[model samples]
Target: MVKDQGLSIVHVCQSMDLVDSVVRRWIKQHEAELEGQPGIGKPLTAEQQRIRQLEAENRQLRADNDPIKKSLGLLCARTEMTYRLIHQLQQKAVPVQQACRVLAVSRAGYYQHRRRGERKADVVASVQLKAAFVASGKSYGSRRLCRALQAQGVIIGRYRVRRLMREAAVRPVWKRKFIHTTDSRHALPVADNVLDRQFDVAAPNRAWVSDITYVRTRQGWLYLAAVMDLFSRKVVGWAMAPTMPAELVASALCMALQQRQPPRGLLLHSDRGSQYASLGYQALLEQHGIVCSMSRKGNCWDNAVMERFFLNLKMERVWQRDYANHGEAQRDIADYIVSFYNCTRLHSTLGYLPPAAYEQKMAAILPIGVSENT
Candidate 1:
């Protein structure tokens, strides 16, 4: 085991706790043993051990970098596995240019392949479908993605879109829901639930729904107050603060008032939180002559549209990150509202059109005076 076989006698002695002579004698007695029968012992010094570890890691890295070495399907099958390979390379920090060059694939062609996923699918349509899904921040499932794809003149079925999503390993993000915190126990005055879950509206500002939700950040919990125009399911106004106060919601209402300037009797509905019930918020609504509507006591379903918006917000954006402070969360939420949700996201209730686009399309066709006042 030592001298004759050229084994590390010192390592054998230390590991087996035997004298070198004893190992030598044992080797002599076991002369019939095949050469290289027992493998070499572990590296003796820490540096040598580290070198061994690095060598193993280097081998793993090489296998990862060379995608074909790990999965033969990457080149030949050339379908879902290809997307997975590109994704794996991306995870390994391999540049897209380098990956395409090594794989002998054109960059544009490879992306088209990766996006479509299945070889049988229409490559262009699949790419467009994936583009829509990704543009929604992976928040649009097959139903919405299909609608978006059709809007772009790429007609595809929902189940087919679902299959492509599975092939691409793409899924919408989901967030854990917290308990509803509407403080309906307050002694403040509350109004009737006039909105009555009638989410569909013919015009932009016939009614609006508002709600308050919280975001967790390192600094503290940041509260978000959003007012959504029911007609278009658009977040017309929003405000964020470290505390849940009447002023937060009032500010959101004020923003909506300034932005829309709808007729005096526009219905504004919200949960019976103390903020919405406060004289300040009520007076702001009164000043604009907006009708006040509240959800039934402890019933979140009454404000379902606004609740859905909050659900979308947390699942798609806020819950995905660990914000260091309220400022970061506030900035991100604002961007999500203005840049994505209002402008780009597809609302199922509005025939898959985004809020802004739906409003614009309606205005283009409907008579001028038939918009808000209706």
Candidate 2:
């Protein structure tokens, strides 16, 4: 009812269409006036009010989580809080079944975690354990792993990390033995044992040792030959093949040659295997001006450095695991030799220092110009 047209009865519409048109025109006129004014409507509905409250609560929860962002430990603490709250509520009259359901936990798990914070300790132990594990190539059990940690200045109970490793299914890699890979019977010229088990070196590439090992695979067997620097015990070069041949060992020797351009008079040592006895391999040493050193005809002990390397590979890594195929063995062996064994695995012979560490120290202190022939 418009008070502006107080004599309203005089201008009334007679038909429905006219009445509708006049009503619309009046609404349009009022809409313009209402644009800057408060809207005429009922207050918020119950559902609308609940939705607004939920939004505010959500914002507050976000603020609460800000302090613990991306921290699993913080998230775990929150979970524990919920569990504790539910437990307390049950003690104070809530039903047991209801409490467990609301807490989102099994009663046993909640109590177990409370009694032993394994998750937190496990995470920390795992980082340490991994270094030791890789360093030892999974050969060391919890006991040896514990000793390794002690040597590194870490103080933690063996059983504690053992339990965590068990829970995480952490186990040292498996190794196994292989025999009959060596063949020294071929009618080829054998070099003299010039170094004569003298494995110690005054500098890099002074004495290089080479050897062969076999790995079993589904396709059959694979052979790997490696050349190591006696100074660092590093696998300076290695080659893999399904068959034993001169070329196989030659390729590995070539890699060592290219890498170390070792000075003339560098002693190249190996077991009296046919591959090492071959003309191709000897020619390589002669061309590079290297002195050839071979093991005594039937004695493995003559080439002690090569023997020790194989023993470590066998007992510490190979003898502990079974490979489904050659490729897997190759990859794991490569990772062990280059990534862990030489670089970081502690050696008792080197005063528990890793090969790389020992080499770095030697390189820093040793004076230059100490040639091998000197």
Best by lDDT: 1
Candidate 2 lDDT, 110-151, residue by residue in tens: 667655765666677778888777667566677767768887
Q: List ranges where model 1 is wrong by over 4 Å.
A: 1-128
Reference-based lDDT, each prediction: 0.83, 0.76
Worst 10 residues of 1 by lDDT: 34-43
lDDT of 1: 0.83
| Candidate 1 residue-wise lDDT at 64 | 78
- Candidate 1 — which pairs collide? none
- Shift of residue 133 alpha carbon in model 2, Å: 3.4
lDDT per residue (tens digit) for residues 1-374 in model 1:
46557769788799889998767666655663546355333337998889999999999987777765456654466645555677799889999888777666678887786656556556666688778877888788989988888878876899988888887778998769585556777899899989888887778888899999999999988998989998788888888998888899998988988898899889999988899999988888888888999888878889888888888888888878899998898889999999999999988788888889989888889876787766
Candidate 2's TM-score reads: 0.58
